[model samples]
Target: MTSLFAQEIRLSKRHEDIVSQRLMLLQQMENKLGDQNKEKTPQMQRAETALQRNLSLLKDIEAAEKSLQTQNHPVPPPEVASLETLYWASVEEYIPKWEQFLLGRAPYPIGVENPNEAEATIQKEVRQ
Candidate 1:
């Protein structure tokens, strides 16, 4: 009976040592995770900041393009007169017949107000 008691005590000690070793390993893993998180957070913040800056720059470029478009002629010289001629020709062909359903005489000399206004005006008139 005494020998049996000694065996039970030794088994209990072994179990306790195993549990302590497992706890130590778990604590070490938790510490490593904490360190990794600390290292990663600053890098993530810097990336976020860079992304925001790039987005802001893109918006500025778009705004600049819009401003430039409204300020002066959007089309180059060689394309301008050709585009105008094509536009007026299409208008002469399409608009009056589509709306009134009868072949009407073409308007004489469809003149543009100015180079800047010509493309937009022609597009609007053609849709009619």
Candidate 2:
């Protein structure tokens, strides 16, 4: 039997792609409408056709999603669930080192070179 979890993920990705494509088509149609002539050119005709197809696909995806939701699925065991939790936490913490290098910025533990500034902040906190 096919895994319901995998099927759900695939459907989610497909839905996102179709929605993005639909938005682009809408933008193209809007731009065509904004032109001074407002004539229905071949390009505009194709855009309208594609938009209709995208809408149809979105409807199909929604139907499949509703069917999927009705079915019951087994849950992962505790150890597996804990590991998955840790994995997602790491993903959240990850800041790409390559991106930081390209931006020429200080990496995470942004150092305080001025000891006096650090001391002053501590003293102010102690006073409060």
Candidate 3:
């Protein structure tokens, strides 16, 4: 099933698309007005006004989107976040070592400086 957040994202994308179309139209109008050598015409003034309004509206939409995101998916607690970090860290550290073992090569610890401790670890693994 689709999620509410996913639906909202689709809606946001639609709004952004419409905004982009309007922005392009506004730019075209501005360019047409720029080509005129006479004093500012009523059409030029109207185009400038519409452009300003659209810019403000784009800002409002962005602000509203950020507010919705913050309200719906707030930051996780520090402890929960730290636990996730540790889980990924362990996965990153062990996956290659296990892969090497599966391929029939003894996987040595990556950063062991003490030779005796490293030997003992290997011996324990062999005994197991």
Candidate that would win on TM-score = 1
* Candidate 2 error regions (>4 Å): 36-128
- What local lDDT score does residue 26 receive in model 3, on the 0 to 100 scale? 100
Candidate 2 lDDT over 44-86, as tens digits, reads: 8889999999999999999998778766545778777776776
For 13-123, candidate 3 gives per-residue lDDT tens digits of 999999999999999999887866355677788899999999999999999999999999999998778767766765676678667766878755464557787567555
Whichever of 2 and 3 has more lDDT, that candidate is 3
TM for every model, in the order presented, reads 0.49, 0.27, 0.45
Better of 1 and 3 by TM-score: 1
**lDDT assessment of candidate 2:** 0.71
| Number of residue pairs clashing in candidate 3, backbone atoms closer than 3 angstroms, sequence gap of 3 or more or interchain | 0
Residue 44, candidate 2: how far off, in angstroms? 21
Best-to-worst order by TM-score is 1, 3, 2
Cα lDDT tens digits, model 1, 1-128, are 99999999999999999999999999999999999999899999999999999999999999999999877866667667777777778777656545444434443334443566667766675555
Off by over 4 Å in 3: 1-40, 98-128
Best by lDDT: 3
lDDT for predicted candidate 3 compared with the true structure: 0.79
Distance from true position, residue 88, model 3, in Å?
1.1
